[model samples]
Target chain A: MKRGVFKRSLDSLESIFLFTSEFVRENHVDPSLLPAIDLIVEELFTNMVEHSSASTADVPMEMSTVDGGVEVTLTDEDADPFDITKVPEVDVERAVEELDPGGLGLHLVRKFADSVEYHYQFSNRQARIVFRKTAGSGGDDV
Target chain B: MFDLERREAGEVVLKGRFDAAQREKAQALFDEIHESVTLDCSELDYISSAGLGVLLKTQKRLLAEGGRLKLIGVNSHLRDVFKYSGFDRIFEIEPG
Candidate 1:
């Protein structure tokens, strides 16, 4: 089951969310769980574009619904084997001035998703998340 | 991503949504400023955490060089985000 692949860009985010949402909403997907999907996607996908494409070069991104959940896998040739789960958490409550908004992207992904896991094979790193259906949940809130 | 532009009065105005895609370009624009930079955040309708990250980094860079990141005309919504993130303690945000 192939989902959809998008070029790394800001304009593509809405389409990605809408496209995934449409697919999820039409079937056995719950409504309360949509925002989580969108948020995690934005957080992870945004990092891919920024750190990979923004600094390096054009990268490949593919997304699909697998195992009864939405999966977005990004492939970046020569990308560092960075794992989002390994990054340290940002102390959002700290008093600071002009601090780089550090640690928010991956932080949001982990906070909103039910479960997030990472895999690396052949130099490609993938962050996979699963959202469980909890009575009234759909990945479309945000 | 955001485009940092230097105005005539020493203002570094950014015009565009600072998302994943525009990040590199924003970095390039940020490199051009040598002093205190006033970022135009009015047209900025939405900012992901990634954008926020870049803004934070850029602010740090400018501040370390005896410069600063001043935001002008930030909408109430984004202002709330800045406030919520406690970024208000970092950057000098002025109402436009």
Candidate 2:
């Protein structure tokens, strides 16, 4: 497959994760791992949808499901230079402590993914996160 | 939005996603239950760290009111979230 392509407004984050989750479950990625995957995808997708700049804001998120695992690559040509890796650690106690309602998405991605890579080249930003079903190969089974 | 209802037996069952979008309402709805409440998590499809925070907050709120909170129909996914966050031990969980 050429991988699934998702292109929509910033408001589509919830549906994006919901749709991707079905694809993950269909791939036999393990029913046990769905929550972690779901959370990570929700967090990541929400970030890409909401945080990206308005100029190239119409960017599309591409997802590929291969033999080994699922790979989500969020691509935005006109997005700002900030890296999703910058999403800080949250004190879970104060996750919503009126402090701020942002940055938790990247934390979820790191916490759940086996490997998270952010590649910014030629003013094009792509955050590719890979989650492996089998543990110890660099990813947690969760 | 989740539609909530009360019982004469002093129990409350929440039906729907207990996620970020619903946490605020869930809290307000939870506050009205003046007695022990058992949340039916079967209809709850997903929850996030924010939602989990709401649960913890509710637990503290209920305990302070001399009331208890229990969760029912917790699937593996939700259970994982609870376990990962250590809320599994915090909530009075009952298997479906």
Q: Which ten residues in a row have the lowest lDDT in candidate 1 chain A?
A: A133-142
The candidates' DockQ values read: 0.23, 0.24
* TM-score per candidate, chains pooled: 0.56, 0.67
Tens-place lDDT per residue, model 2, B16-88, is 5555555567778766766677877776767776566666666776777787778998765677566555465
Candidate 2 on A43-130: residue-level lDDT in tens?
Answer: 6655555566464444455555655566666565565666666666765454322323245445555656766777666535443444
lDDT of 2: 0.59
TM-score of 1: 0.56
Looking at candidate 1, what is the lDDT of residue B67?
A: 78
Residue A129 deviation, candidate 2, in Å?
5.0
lDDT of 1 at B9: 72
